[model samples]
Target: MKIFKRTKIKKYSKDGRILFTKEMKKEYTILIPMMLPIHFKFMKNILVKHGYKAELLNTSHSRIIEEGLQNVHNDTCYPALLVIGQLLDAIKSRKYDEDKLALIITQTGGGCRASNYIYLLRKALKKNKLEHIPVISFNLNGMEKNPGFMIRPSLLVQFVYATLYGDILMLLSNQVRPYEINPGETDRIVDKWVIKLSNELNGKSFFSKRNIKRNMEQIAADFAHIPVKKVDKIQVGIVGEIYMKYSPLGKNSLEELLAQEDAEVHIPGLMDFIIYTCDNRITDTKLYGINIIASFLAALLKNYLIRMQNMLIDAVKTQYIFKAPSSFDHIKSLVKGYIGTGVKMGEGWLLTAEMLELINSGIENIICTQPFGCLPNHISGKGMIRKIKERHQNANIVAIDYDSGATKINQENRIKLMLSTARLNLLKAADDSEAFLDNAQTR
Candidate 1:
């Protein structure tokens, strides 16, 4: 197979629309998947502010899965299917002119299927008779530079900020909700803040780091009064590819299901991705004979990410009280031993990284969610479960595969069985410990 390193073609034509333009009219629409709901909204508002019209398609849950199976290879990763299905669904909507539509998805250019997702999405579109529609693959590496879309540096910064915000909020909400006095208050709070911040970010002046810090602080302060239990509950960690961890659609809403089961969810937050990306750059330097400067750059980025995560921890501590067992140092320790840096980015090594972190933190039970057909996840997730469990006898793990053809009730039943075993083991351990203490005292 040949690899292409060039950016967008200098000249291209699709549906009679020429590539290259500073101005965008209502004629073109950009479509994105559900994981980027907030992102798409922010982009839409910003694009409209910049005089371009943007529309978002509602593509998530079973709809994305069904579309994926119908259009894409069953063996492909779920992200590819969901994304492709989203574009196909949008094109079929007939709300937008077919010739004026374009689909957009992030391209990380890593070793995983994610690198080929754009091409797959394009093929799916062409097969569906939507060949004229353009597929815009966004990459920081400048992989694609069509005139129809250009991601300004400022816009990228805002997108990063949005990811951090979304990730942190999701983390806090998961921890708070299981024990909240009002069951849905945390979710309501998240909704309120998402709207507030989305509107604030739409402005020209609110895109600075200083402002982002202030907003993070304000978000913490806003819901500071929500009541939560001070006692410890069963802490269950979530580990898998990035999508399964972040997007409910990808994992079949596994986090919510765990919360409903009265378990405190503890998945490593998004700041880890920043650390992982930096680490990858250093790895690239070693592999490609690049400069040591990449390693230095990675160290600098790690320091900043560590500092940011510390701030987030501080804020979360102030608002929602839950056990944070390991510091960044402890969590970082797991990254090297379990999953090496050579592992492809975005969910491959990251999932293994999080699983190891959870075990190190004394989180004995974990639910590893993988898309039904995601290959890398299968290898790193269920593939290594036996080894992880062998190392830690108390490890209670279950792997759930999500796809359109899968039934929800059946998935829940499997998780329930795992939870039952975990609970029983936990109770037996406590009893044994108490018995040993009593016998020692009597002696």
Candidate 2:
């Protein structure tokens, strides 16, 4: 028997010099994936306006998957495959000068396979013989320093609005788009406001305490005006790995798939995950002997995020059927008996808390989607399933494993079976309501 020998990955020299040269700055475009389209639009605009070129890579063709399969291993998580694939495929397309190009990928710098995603991407680029293309890690912690790229305070403020606004838009759009009486009206409104809000977020004056609060209120009001029709539809909450939770590419157009199933989708906003990630830093300080400065920043971010979430909720609840997100403290409280907040890896305690949040909110049908071999999801998701189900007997929960090797049909079939159970429960509840009404009328 002959074992295939794997090529040893070469390490890049750590001389603190950026891979992106100053000469390439004028023409170099950094290619990144689209997790939240609206947020990325705002972010891309900010990056470009600051004398850098940033492009959101999304190809609606089958070649996206083909490129992923060709370069990455079958056992890699779905998002990693698609992201690495999207980058490689775009590079091969030769739309830009190979010499003047770079790629930006987010490294959570947490305890997951994702922290090493850059290494895998480097390997893939090497295999494709595009080794000259620089890869940058877009993280707040300065994991990989690049002289060509830096996060300034002004840009950070814009990103704050980008995230808060994106969260507001995402939260409202999910509710509006599915039920809007006028086809495409929801999307039209969302697009219109994203541009309007992006413009409002540009100036220093825009970030003042008064203006930020006003903008959050106004953004909520704008989404509330999207003429939505009240309809009885099965509301399904999608909670899982951060990427799979929101990214269409990662989850195979899951929101659309639910729409086809006549289900109203409820995705916890990206802000929740962002807050969870930030909150983990504070938790990390408690866990290990992490620095006090890191703890202070994390706490500051956690507070700001909580306030922003509440502001959107208050403004939107006046007109729409919007449910404000739970506070970080509340989410942490959720996992006390079932799991610990200490289980902070991958989606960690946040995944369990999200499921519990959805269950409590009457959106009992849930799909906990995770990539195969994702240990954190395995522990926090499937591991806590029994505990969650024991508490909520009517919870129609399904955990779907997404891997490169998993077929769409097979994955969908499992979802269908879960939905079938959900439909039955819905019918039973309707019957019970009708029976009670009939009995009262007879009396």
Q: Tell me, what's the RMSD of every candidate?
A: 5.7, 5.3
TM per candidate comes to 0.83, 0.92
Q: Give the TM-score (vs. native) of candidate 2.
A: 0.92
Model 1's alpha-carbon lDDT is 0.69
lDDT of 2 by residue, 1-443 (tens): 11121112122448532366454556789998777777788888778777888898766456878888888886777778888888888888979876667999888888788887788888898898787678888888778866667888888877877777777778778877878788988788778877776676557766786776777777667667777777767889999988787778778777778888988888887777888888888888898868679889889978987887777667666664676666667767877788878888898998999999899888899999887768888899878888899999999899888766678898899888888888888889889999999999999
* Per-residue C-alpha lDDT of model 1 across residues 101-197, encoded as one tens digit per residue: 6677778866766778877887787788765666676777666667757778667566666667765676766667777787779878888877787
Candidate 1 regions exceeding 4 Å error are: 1-26, 36-52, 61-63, 202-210, 229-233, 291-303, 323-329, 404-407, 425-443
Residue 16 lDDT in candidate 1: 39
- Checking candidate 1 for backbone clashes, the offending pairs are none
Give lDDT per model, in order: 0.69, 0.79
